[model samples]
Target: MTLKPARGLAVLLCVLSPLAFAQADAVRKPDPNTRVPQGVIHHAATGFPDRIVASPLQAGDAGFAVSWRTSPAVDAPMLEIVVAGDSPDMGTPRQVSSRTQALQTENGDARYHHAVIDGLQADTLYAWRVQGDRTWSAWYHTRTAPAAGAPLTLLYFGDTQNQNTSLTTRVIREAMRHAPDARLALYAGDLVSGGDGEDDNEWAEWFEANDPLTTSMVVAPAPGNHEYFEEFEDTPMERRVLGAHWPLQFALPANGVDEAKETTYWFDYQDVRVAVIDGTSALDLGTAEAQARWLDGVLSGNPRRWSIVLTHQPFHSPRAGRDNVLMREHLLPVIKRHGVDLVLQGHDHTYARRGADAAPTPVFVVSVVGAKQYRLSEQARATMRPVGEDTQLFQVLRFDGGRMRYEARTATGRLYDAFELIDEADGKRLVEVTEGRIDERRCDREATLKGRKDRCWE
Candidate 1:
């Protein structure tokens, strides 16, 4: 197979350069000592062939759900949850209960499967695993939400499309290095390249890229523009492939808008209410009325101290001059009234941060982890306090007591930017990080010239 570099990682064809490819292929084989294969793709054994994933881990609470896939579409994958206490002799977790249900793929593949493991104890570490007929995955452990009022921590990532398997892994692994047990992970969308309309391999590369972290971590994903596939009623290939794979891989809260478009939903953690909206549906298709209504309900009804909104498009764009002004026109007021703390997004393929102000000035961020590059927009430079044109980065947000600190770091652990969002109910204070010299250009309209100029004051 001939392969080309997308984001930044050099793609190696399985057949190209026979000697090198052969050596690389030799490493992907399942090892007796390793938990997962290095290179070969592994079909989730416990759930559908697509996903053997754990998600919706109740934040600041002690409960979570484990969803997986099974071949031949079994009734349910066996779930074993064991709470680890002080005693080292807890041995292995015994079988608790199971759910038998059919997972229907949006594209009409009935072979899909799903199950939720609920009602586990709180603030405790639990060892669990999924089991199918001929395949039983190795046991893994997860820490539930600390407590209802306890401070929470999460990792935020924007776009990881394009050269996913190569550059994406570095950023993800770096985030874990900063905080391995981050309670939650947020995505601004465009998790994969080759838009939902075509480029099936990008999806595979995406799954392959994040397999290291997602297999054990809980991630909340919102759809980005690239996730949308242009298709008429007659042939919706993108929806079929991406849709079938998304639900199969990640188990999200089934609770969402009655009339909202697909995969748009909301779920609450201890003191936080997180809502994910399908921006593409709302912006391009004009079919997100139900979603808008649902957002209203979630925000109006939510009683959490913090409400964070996730979408693929950014409200305060550093690029495209906030091209999604239509989206802002509709949802901005709702967010303003509801007191949303953070607005996470992707699509710009760069890193940006704005001051947190009381006038519904939510901290809008656009960071990309993939290898794709884009010129920094003039508006982004003029508006955002800090914007990077050529950096691959991820962010870590830690909520410890009354103070919330957000740190953005490069794949190599250099601090790119930082901010503090205090929950005074009044607003968060702005703290600029000047650890590194940011003497880089603000905007390079000719995508090729981005980051090649110097404009920052020394």
Candidate 2:
């Protein structure tokens, strides 16, 4: 089967056109006086379908959702689908009209369309595309979750925020190269550093970086702090709100807390139940208790064999003088009572992994995929074994009958860290897969008193 790069033509036109550049300049020319000015709209929406992404459904069901963008909110777009076939036509396809929403940005106006398909047979692969703007997107493959107790693979990324199209893009593609059949791409927030009005280009870079992968695998994203900004900035009534592009870019499950619908949601695939918590909204924007209540109800009644928590902030703070204490106070108890197996987090640009303390304890992980890196603190190093600093990495996790295997690889796809969580009779036991791992990468320490410091130290 040909792996056509879906919407490649439209993305190129959006990224490289001179007219798009002129429009970007007209919309948001950065102020030279400001420290970090707004960026131009490099990946403006063309008349064609672009930024196509597939997301997962909730309730442990076997289906997926597709979303895409058009320049001026076309109401006639259709999300066409069929069981994936050998030829390009994808056999005889069935169609459903996409629900459309008008989205306005500083760059201009565009249309966002989404469609949800569920109740299909399990362990099935399907081909789908969006038709609008007098053109059809390239056919792409998406799959339902494998049968229960089957081997399921997923890719987890932390903060693909800055320099995504250039630097973070490779790691993402490398992940697909390593595990091409990965069922989903799960993000622990900060997928793009800019959801603010002036940062539309960053979202474009993100779409371009994910590219073909975004169209294929189901995307499960939680909102990080960067996904929000003040509505009326520098004003008396300014209030922090989720990004406008968020709802338009991805259509996630609305089964979370009523106030923070898609941002705080839960879904199940095979044996694992994944809960996406909006720590940014919970702690920063006064929805902590509501999400906590929702989280408690969801996790307490979770029907899956295992539960994994995906969120922006960590329960255990790694950096000194930085703790999400309020969020932890509200949500950690529920996590413990419910015995969530793994907690995936981002926002610490450094990578740190902390194993469970005892039986039913959750294993915590924080990683970064962006080019930007930070120093791993001494406390983090002490608490979290196998910590890393100034490194960019992506992780591929696989779950089989009784074991969950995780491998963290570099941009070049070399094995840097590995682990296994074995489901025992009592609880899941943590096992570090250490044989093939390369030496732990870290900045050198100062030994001689006047010696030139390593670049990371500086």
Candidate 3:
């Protein structure tokens, strides 16, 4: 049997004639900027008000693959891509093209609709919206990555799992304010607070917090353990939503195999190659075979100037239940072999920076942006090297043609950590950062619940 490209992989182009174009100029055009107009429209196989999101628009790739949600979802939903080119003046933007097709929707409690807009020109700006039946979303726009060898800037955030709207929002907005020209946003996962098992309100909060940032920020998120449902054994309903939320929210790369296809994949931005992995899948469920194999292949295939690995579990972490020995055993070896420059993770609910344990110091960092806080123990503080607490943080990473620089800061703009990774012929050189003094105060004083710590950081 022959394997087929995933439903959203098709590219449709039309060869237009000169005389036909002249005659078509007589037809009337509709306004594309109109709001979806609040009205009940028949749910297209792929149309609903999902937590609409876009991932990094790689160099030479088409428009972003937008994923959204709808109930009673089918395997396929028709998606429409309307492209609007950039403009120099502040007047109306120019329309480039538009097309529609049937794409697949991964279904469950939160059904997912995904489609890739192909044939986009590199380094050009474009606007698009996904629709089903009569329902259409506000057009969103993203600029494709500049061609290879171009300088780039990307933002990285750890965990946004607690009190998302109130806490994480301030930190995220501040990060964007510091560096407004970032190309892509890399989230280490736990993008939501579904760990408590209450789905409806929790997801809404996550969306509310991220919506403002995502307007222009192309996000790529890995799954943290908090993304998992609390009840594992009983409800099939819960199992259905296990990994469904991710696909419905963000349109990621589909080149990986099996579970890694959309959940764990690699893509190129400018001169850098980024690999996103699922620590939850590999560590919790023991499906490391495909990710490991895919990771190796991705490294072997990469010729980019810089390579980075992203996940939710850190090999060097200060939080409890964070050390995923399985990931270290299977995945870290590949990263080391590939000479990856950076590894970003979150699960500790704090920020930390560590020196390279393996040969080349692959600068490893962990951070959090939620209301949920934890204390770093003596062992954790000692082992993790640089530690932070009772603070919400975000990272701004810049990759120029020559050097890579990163800064960790709090929502109030207090500098926590800062460093530069100098690129060399053999490998990258790490520069130690000295910023704010490590806050050693413990937050868990009075017991809150039976199982976990009580006072966060008073």
Candidate 4:
């Protein structure tokens, strides 16, 4: 498959090379050592649901969607939810029917089940569990989104594709610890390194990294290029396909373009509306116009006070020679017209916060939370100052009535950058709040040498 080069960037099409294709195929192969031993009597053995996650199906959290995995033995799966009380016992559990699918995985065959619990009370704490055959998972508690005008904080992560089980795990745990009250965790795509998205061990490690968090906090994810895979018959790759596990693993809203249904959707939390787009499909396939049309409608009908867009590729590339010109040309106009407050992105391994130069509509930010590091490009330095090269970082964003505060922290919980966006009657203002923060991390010779020793400065 040959992708048309984005404007002024011929290297973007190099991803179709045989070497890159081979490397992608190799990365998707499951590691034998990481696979679960056959006949092991684990939680997945008795149909105990795992990888449990919750998402909003409607605005104001009137409805919630949940998905999980169970053993093959448990064909008929169900979800039981109840309003939590002081006691350990759930009183009068409301049972919801679930749709189940049989999936053939590298480890073995398993059933993925999903159910949407609707008519949930706003701001109410509910305890829920999944039942398969005679086994049931432990009850987990989750709070629905509060009414509009409620203040909330959210955790954002970028490109946790490498070292997902080890380094990524630590970063997520630390971010969660720092913001325990975070209502939702948003991943800017590339959740795993597997290009085909079928590597069982890589998926396992990713789930393990999120262990108990998925059961409680809501997860909003986008698909990166790595989340897609291409299959070849003889020599050259033929068609690009989404990861096999994507649809089965995530139960997102279906309010998106037909080409990218669940992968591209929008949801409203409090006063903010978040629209997720499929950048990979837009760039590789011919779905840019379709997504752009859908995005225009979504933005035009927006009733929320603040609107945000999340995508795998940045509208403005942080690297010198790399830029998603097609994405910018197709989607940036819609974002600007809608007066989006923020645009969160990943796929660039460096850290950059742009749009501070008198941009009133949206603030663009690119960040990373995994070990993969890239040097800041000359274009990035010229366009986006206060950039972090060879750094692993995460962002915590808080949303109030008319103010949004953002803080970027390193792996060790050090403050790297800070800013706030205040919306006034005139327009939005970006306030630099990085007082007493450390200086920007540049890729100097000493840091490059240390990076070779696995000690890159954050």
Candidate 5:
């Protein structure tokens, strides 16, 4: 097929080339096994397919969901899938058509396409590619979520809003270095700096920065406050509404409240139930009550072995004068009653993780991986433990049945913290595995000694 890149590793290397050059000002030795094929577009642009992402469906879903974008929409965007080891160009690869959603942004009109690929065997590896502008993208490898007994791992990030292209790519690359075969890339929120209307450039940068990973790892993004844009601006009363790019950019399962469609949705990926809440819409808009009700139902009787809540703003705010009280009041009860395992969140511009040794409450994690940095407020310094400031971070988690191993790492691939949780027959036990982790990351005396341009902390 015209789309086939020999092993798909060359395109991956090509995508990471910019970051690699940024690191060493030189090209690293290419892998002897990789080959660059023709028709590979190295950067995101009009008429070329970019910003591709995959997401989960039902628990043990036989298939998965993928979304991509292009300018000048193709007449019929298609998906081609083949068994991992099979010749990609040989037999007729299973074909599926995509539904296109056209979006007009500051840059121009871009077409977003969504496709559902199903009827595949469970726990099987597949390489797939998308057709855009009559051109096919590089092959990306993804596997069907394994049945209940299979192993699963996920890479989680807090935010990649500011400096997404340069700095954020470092953390994402480091994350992939640690968990190359991770099944899911979970974002706590603020995936982009949508403080203004959706900037196609930002989305393009986001996808490019993590392109190699997104096409394979698949993303489950939560909506942070930054995801909401001021709609109807210049009116008597301008209101912030959820950015249109969200629902169009991602074809999430429509299992959330009617008020919060793609933003507040949940799905089962292997043995984990991933519930993403739109705290931005809930607190700023009017979806609190509806979402709260829907979340209760979603989590109350969930049958998955593990349940994780992905929200933008964290309830237990480590920063002083910041608390998502409305969200906590509405959703914490449901989480507690359901015995949710982990709550991954972002938007605080810092890192803080709070866990309970004896209590059954969920372990709440607030982290940020972007260039933006914030100091630990007095509330955090006085209360929360395992706090990190002035450092970009990422988390990789491994799940084998009822036990989970978690690691939090820095932008340069240093282990910052490590922990594990085991859901025993009696109850859940939390263990801190901090042997190899570096000391807690905090600003130094120079930070406080520096001027405003490099002020240490807020």
Candidate 6:
């Protein structure tokens, strides 16, 4: 079941090698004015896969998708899978072919390979590996989604966009320590600070920081404004487009609006239906109506007991001028009509939660996980409850028979907020579950006088 590189790539490489070598020799003098194309320094193929990731393709069908990166030499990428038993070697491995896409980054040209493994038994643990030209990646294990009505837990993160990956990495690792059994890691976009998604260094740092976690835990991501910005000195802000590397990096489900398939998709894990919407497209690309129609169809046909929506921009912005009025005006009603239980969003760089004033149908939340911080606008403060500024946080959600418990914790793992949703015979209701949460973190005169300047809001 081994895959091979396309003949075209081989031919192109062969035709260009001699000229490339000659150019390299001539450039040895290293003229300061001389310019070299990015990703020109190619590395020799090591015959090993790197940056392996597993994601959900179709939860209803128990399908999981795997993707990894390998050197250019390994044209045909392959995946080996087996059901786990008491020992790692207990089951016979099944080898499957994969689809590979070649991409040129600032470092060099590499191929990203993807494969979707279906017919997996729910709640079963599976061991898998990726094959390089010379060797196979070490076997990694992941568990499939459990049956409906079964209790499940997931980790939620906001924007991880930062100048460096250290802060996001630290927070992710800390979160794993608390919910090690979490089935999936859900992100509300802005995975990197790359304005145009062309910075190879930033992408490398992000992937390196989340290597093994991504290999096992399924990642559900939405696209943020940062993910859409293009990095160009002459390109005006309005001319920015979606990052070029986005579609190449992650293999997400394609069940979304035709124009924004990968960025806008949905998957159901057990009884919870999670829909990721592309807020950037809705706001900037004039794709709002199409997405809205697609969303209505998705919601109308959803059979899951509980529905959760994930988007980059909040319906109610936590920052005054940052409000996504377009999203709120167009998509909010659809969400409310469908009785969405929770809406998790990012992009505000602040934390705020607002349960609908009249009902508990959709509890909206906005949070940040990166080092960047923003003040809670006075308007936001007046609207949302328990607002926080200058903070980095992560959320853990657990769903059981008739209850869902959500906990928001600071990077240090201290509880900052808590709530519960109870689905009873009458209807679903939001209940405050914050008994031991730390006092609301805010900047005040006392804190300023005490020299804890970072705690104060701007």
- Pairs in steric clash, model 2: none
In order, what lDDT does every prediction score? Answer: 0.66, 0.79, 0.67, 0.80, 0.79, 0.80
Indicate the TM-score of model 1: 0.77
Alpha-carbon runs more than 4 Å astray in model 1 = 1-51, 57-62, 73-75, 85-111, 195-201, 233-242, 356-360, 425-427, 436-458
Q: Write candidate 2's Cα lDDT for 1-458 as tens digits.
A: 54357777666666786666545444553222112335545556777898889998884346888889888837758888899877765667788777899877766788899998877777888888898778888888888888778888999998888777777789888889999878888898888777444567777778878888888788999888888887777899888888888888898988989968858888888888999999888887788888889999988778677788999888776655578987778888888889888899998877788866665358888988886566667789788878887678889999998898988888888888888888888777877789877777885443112233322321
Candidate 5: deviation at residue 330, Å?
A: 1.1
Query: Model 6 over residues 1-458: C-alpha lDDT tens digits?
Result: 53366876676667886667555444443221112235454332356787678888767438689888888888867798898778745667888889988888656788888888988889888888899977889988899999999998898999887643556777888788888988888899888776432465666666766666797779888888877764464746445578766887788888899978768998889889988899999988877778888888889978888899999988898776676778878888899999999999998888899988799879999988876666678888788887887778999999998999999999899998899999989989888987889877764322222233333321
Pick the winner on lDDT between candidates 3 and 5: 5
Query: What is residue 47's positional error in candidate 4, in angstroms?
Result: 2.0
TM-score of 3: 0.76
Candidate order by TM-score, highest to lowest? 4, 2, 5, 6, 1, 3
Lowest lDDT 10-mer window, candidate 4? 449-458
Report the lDDT tens digits of candidate 1 across residue range 1-458. 53446522443343357566445544553212112244443333333244455677434364666655555545555676677656756677767455544433212223333445566666667777776665566666777766657878888998887667667878888898898768778888888754333333455457667765665666788877666555553564433223445655566777776544356877776566889987777777664566666788888867677778998888777665457866778887777777678888888777777654544347777787776655567777787867887778889988776577788888788887877766665665555557663444343232221222222100
Task: Give the C-alpha miss distance for residue 320 in model 6, angstroms.
Answer: 2.7
For candidate 4, write residues 1-458 as lDDT tens digits.
66565742566545477666545544553323223455442333335667778876757468588888878887758899999999986689999999888777656788889998989888888899888668788888888887888888888888888667667778888898888888788899988877533366667778887766787778889999878887673557677789777888888988989988858999898888989999999988878888999999998978888888999998888866677878888888888878888899998888998883457558898999876677677788888857897777888999999899999898878888888889899988888896867889865433322334222322
TM-score of each: 0.77, 0.86, 0.76, 0.86, 0.86, 0.85
Cα lDDT tens digits for candidate 3, 1-458 = 54355523332113555555444533524221111233423223333545666676454344556665554443445554434544433345333222222323222244556666667766766666655435666677677777777778888988887667667778878888898888688899888766443344455557667775664656778877766754555766334225445555676777765765557877888788888888878876667776888889988968788888899988776775556788888988888888788899888777777766755467788888776667665667776656877778888888888688888878877777888888788767877667563443345333323234533431
Could you tell which candidate, 2 or 3, scores higher by TM-score? 2
lDDT score, candidate 3 = 0.67
